[model samples]
Target: MPQISAFDVVGPIMVGPSSSHTAGAVRLGLAARRILGEPVTHADIGLHGSFAATHWGHRTDVAILAGLLGMSMDDSRIPQAKELADAAGLQYAFQTVDLGDVHPNSVRMRVLGKENSIEVVGASVGGGRICIYEIDRFEVEIDGSYTVLLARYKDQPGVVADITRILASYGINIAFMKVSRKTRGSDALLVAETDDPIVDDVLELVRQLQGGIVARRLPRF
Candidate 1:
């Protein structure tokens, strides 16, 4: 006989199956959707390593699609995600790729919306946990455990301070912060993990700042 835990369940609570293949994959897709902040009209998914090898058997493909549709890990609709996406007119395709030196259970999604597109790379680290490692071309580390603020802006001096100032005004405490850029004076990305939710006003103010292209708040799933 064997023991079972919550993480083994594909759904909620009771044990079901592999957490890395099901729940973790679901969370990865959900995180990417939250970062995009819009309905995905198309998704070009790249499955890597173990994810590619076992995707079909584990239902990882459907899991990712369900997450892109904004479904939770426990949502029974996950199994029917393909049909739902078709009904919603969301186009999607999946391909296998070799992402060198990455985790075995990794996926890269290029999600396209009517107005914008986002590329996210993440790894399912098992036990229903995941870590997002990149957004677009910017390297990041998001564990989906905290309220997060993500902003894209022109690479210039004082922008970081300006964004932080707005958060301070909202009385929100910072838990962590990271900045990534391609080159000097180019577009840059800022990711701030917070102790509390950011208000809409503060988010708007940050978006209004000079060089601000986009600002989005991601709540923990």
Candidate 2:
């Protein structure tokens, strides 16, 4: 038998009606926002499966917009997400899409900022829990259960070792680590989940690594 946690029993505290449709959608959006690491100027969101079939009635669209706008799931302003977005100068659109072989309640977001852009694909599994599967076309598995460190850099030998070494120097225990690259000796992405929060100083050290790496921290939800 699967062990049930408190979240499983009580579900998430949220504004929308359904956990899977509303809370999950909000989390998915938040994950994308964190990965982008900037204010969202424009967003092109694609809904799949159940999300595409009945998003309007469940307020999934509004929930997603609310998340992108940096609102929490329980925020009172979720129902007014569109209006809030307009006030914040955010432009967005949603469309149904075929995201092959993914969870039913999934979304793909292409978000643009003033100086950067990111493409994130993820799903809200249940109880407001989400799994971020892809970022910038790199396959990954991030569940937002721990503080996450994301680094993008030119593929090179010893890069992973150096990163782990930095974490070790700070006594930060790594809960999980995943590395993916487009091709040998090309661009790569590192996803490291830690048991403790990574302070800005540590993140800055990661940014100073060789190969012009760009590093960002995503706090646990």
In model 1, the worst 10-residue window by lDDT is 8-17
Could you list the CA RMSD of all candidates, in the order they appear?
Answer: 3.6, 1.2
The TM-scores of all predictions, comma-separated, are 0.92, 0.96
User: Candidate 1 overall Cα lDDT vs. reference?
Assistant: 0.88
lDDT string, candidate 1, 29-138, tens digits? 88988888899999999999999999988999999998999987888788899999999998999999998899999999999888779999999997888999988889
List clashing residue pairs in candidate 2. Answer: none
Question: All models: lDDT?
Answer: 0.88, 0.91
* TM match of model 1 to true structure: 0.92
Q: Against the true structure, whose TM-score is highest?
A: 2
